[model samples]
Target: MIGRLNHVAIAVGDIAKASAVYRDTLGAEVSAPVAQTEHGVTTVFITLPNTKIELLEPLGADSPIAKFLERNADGGIHHVCYEVDDILAARDKLIADGARVLGGGEPKIGAHGKPVLFLHPKDFCGTLVELEQA
Candidate 1:
């Protein structure tokens, strides 16, 4: 079952610039940037009590995050992640209910040290869905 709503992921052209804006300008305390090689991106986390905000930047041209930026043509909100208690079961149930998963598999390590999976936007009324295990 789903737990609390986690961080909202945002795509950015430059992670450092985004971090400065979020931390210095917006007065949010940011965590040291973390690189998620498997996901093909780097990210910085802005911690909050209930949730966090993640700033994502593609690590290379082949990265899916890079394609995301190109497709949108503007760095902005990428997806909303909801924390779950059991990722495998969640994925199974979603699949059984006819939800289309992006990778159609188990949750993998993503930004902020959590196991994450992306559900196709087509399955959620054009809103990209993220399932995360904390």
Candidate 2:
């Protein structure tokens, strides 16, 4: 089952510019960009009181974020991540309930360096849902 909200991810053409908007204009605490090669994204996290906002820039032409940006030129909300105490169990339950899991239903190391899984958007109110191990 899902736990608390982990972070909301935003797809951006440029992570630097997005970080500045949060850091300079919004006066938020943003972290330095860190490349997640496996995930094919460069991330910048804006820490908040209850959760975090993740800014994602495509790492390469083949990156998924690149495709997302192609469809959404100006970029927008990418996905929402929720923490889970037992990711594997949650995956199994979601599967049994006929929910589709992305990436062949396997857990991948996320931006937070935690095991994570992405569920199909259609199954969750047209919003991509990411489950992260707590």
Candidate 3:
């Protein structure tokens, strides 16, 4: 089952600049940048009063974020991640209830260092959904 709403990811061209802007301009406290080499990106997390904001920048040319940014210059909301109690169960339930998964059928480690899986946008009312277990 789903728990709470986790961080909402925003794909950016530059993580440091975005983190600086959020910290200095908006007075948001940013967390230390972390590298997710498996996913091919570096991220800086800015914790908010409610939910967290993740500033994601591509680490290399073959990174997915690179294609995302290339597809849209303005950059858009990448995905919405939700905290789940059981990722496999949640995934099964969602699929049983008619949801399409984007990546692996099993959960994989995400940017937050938790098991995560993405439901396809087509199955999520045109918005990509990420289910993660804390």
Model 2 worst lDDT run, 10 consecutive residues: 60-69
Off by over 4 Å in 2: none
Q: Higher lDDT: candidate 1 or 2?
A: 2
lDDT of each: 0.84, 0.93, 0.84
Ranking by TM-score: 2, 3, 1
Per-residue lDDT for 24 in model 2?
A: 95
lDDT tens per residue, model 1, 10-101: 99988899999998999998988887777788889888777889888998657877777887666989999898888888889998998888
- Tens digits of per-residue lDDT for model 2, 4-122: 99999999998899999999999999999998888789999999999999999999667888888999999999999999999999999999999999999989887787999999999
* Residue ranges of candidate 1 with Cα displaced over 4 Å: none
Which runs of model 3 end up more than 4 angstroms from their true locations?
Answer: none
Residues 12-53 of candidate 3: C-alpha lDDT, one tens digit per residue: 987778888999999999988888888898988889999898
**Candidate topping lDDT:** 2
Worst 10 residues of 3 by lDDT: 72-81
